[model samples]
Target: MTDMPDNIVMPFEIKPLGVRGRIVRLGAVVDDILHKHDYPAPVSALLAEAVALTAMLGASLKFDGKFILQTNSDGPVDLLVADFSSPSGIRGYARFDADMVAALKEPTPQALLGKGHLAMTIDQGQGMERYQGIVALGGVSLTEAALGYFQQSEQIPTRLRLAAGALAQRGLRPEAWRAGAIMVQHLPRDGGISPQPFDSGDAPEGSKEEVTEDDHWVKARLLLDTVEDHELLDPMLTPEELLYRLYHEDGVTVYPAVTLERHCTCSRDKVGDLLKSFSDDDRAHMNSNGVIDVTCEFCSTHYQFAPEEVEPAPEARAQAQ
Candidate 1:
């Protein structure tokens, strides 16, 4: 097998394409986001891609912000989420039925999601409108659906490459699994036309400008379609090496490697606040004698709070606040 490289920002470039084109580089952090959740095979795989896609897209945002990817489905896989910050902090979660997930084999987003929408939320963090896009979860894998969204919605030539296969756990976590992914996007340009992916001629020409665009789109499309599954999931390929291997001939300038890790923000007190959201009647029903148990699905952090712990919402009440 070909060796891969370590985790880093990999490299990216933001310059003019034919006249004014933009590009981005995404690395393996996508896999890291999925490790925090004990997702079913297919669910985890899609979530990992969503996470990587979010990070990759967020990396290209013009302002300071975060990108959130979420889904509300009705299949064995109930919910999936991925969050990425501008500087590139990645986090994700997947919720599914224990019994059903183990026996799951569905890969189609429609089959896995039943009926739902794919939402992308961007928080500028400065009181901006916080861009949000919601589209039907239509068709096969999320990778294909997301690429479609980029084309029709965001109006960008984007490629989302993901690897959500199982990874050998470290230390005593033997049976555990990990995921990885990478995203590449060609941002929109002023003119309706962008550089042709692979054209070996000076003053690129076609039947017409539209024809040139179609040709350009086709050339790039072919190159992206050629990306193999091995290139995406291989840990040894490091972000830099992967880019150089794939786009070197096309003249890609990698930026720098970005560090990534898995994070869970659940807390005991936070769980209590969630329980408080329910009405007194609802809370009372969930309570058995006194203890109200709350478990975070992402990290499996269990928090138990007695009935007495549920109190009025006072800034001073640790749980209420």
Candidate 2:
């Protein structure tokens, strides 16, 4: 494992098998987003997982746009959203019933989001039509749900491992949050080039036999299953090192790394524009203490606007004139 300087998304491929993968390590960026909200450990950890998954999956897009992962459910946690903008910007937030969440001893994804639907949306900027795919959340972990989405929605064979937690270091005011994820996919091959046969000899005991493409997928998944939570969340482990630790025998080839950062696109002007769309009466109803206060859900940034500061719509302006 090489020493990576900071938050990065590293892409890699195992030669001759058409298997591609990505490893993402988020450090200060995740800490920045999660620290803004005083979320319970489970809520914070789940949101961190979403953020890491967004970065991993978002690296595949060839367009300059935004990728959003969200879930809506009837359980204690009703809403969760994570966004990845083109060229490596990410932010996320979650909403839940505080009392209900506090009572959960082990808040797995399913427990937090009972009967929920996970959705992935791609917005290719203005004028381009957005694309979305939805799947029922039925897996033990968010990683498994994501893999199911790709298999059922995109018809791609995918495997993922994700982890998030806080790390304690001596002088920090609060423990820093860290998140990491690894994803591998078998891209459809052309011309019938057989998948590079993998020998199961290196696999741990009690592993299933491998013979065909499906068997190869099983082998890959088994390898992924060997990853531990600590390995994923460890700040010192570089992507290269982690990949080598897992697939060094298979011979891993890593590509250039992409840096990631915590960024929120919300601005006072955007909030004002949204407020301008409301009818005069509606805006008046939203005002408190003679001013309207708006908070961005993604970043919790507060914006204050007096009625005069929000430019009225053209029709409203014409009527006023």
Highest TM-score among the candidates is held by which one? 2
* Candidates in order: C-alpha RMSD to true structure: 6.8, 6.2
lDDT of 1 at 157: 57
lDDT of each: 0.60, 0.83
Candidate 2: residue pairs that collide: 1-241
Cα deviation of 311 in candidate 2 (Å)? 4.8
lDDT of 1 by residue, 157-270 (tens): 565655555656466545433344555554445445444343335654672343245444444445555767766665555655655565556655655555655556678777
Candidate 1 clash figure, as a count: 17
Candidate 2 lDDT, tens digit per residue, 108-210?
Answer: 8778887878899999999999999888865346877787787667666677889999998666545899999988877635523234344447877867465
Clashes of 2: 1
lDDT of 1: 0.60
Give the poorly placed runs of model 1, Cα more than 4 Å off: 1-11, 14-38, 62-64, 98-110, 168-171, 175-178, 187-211, 214-218, 313-321
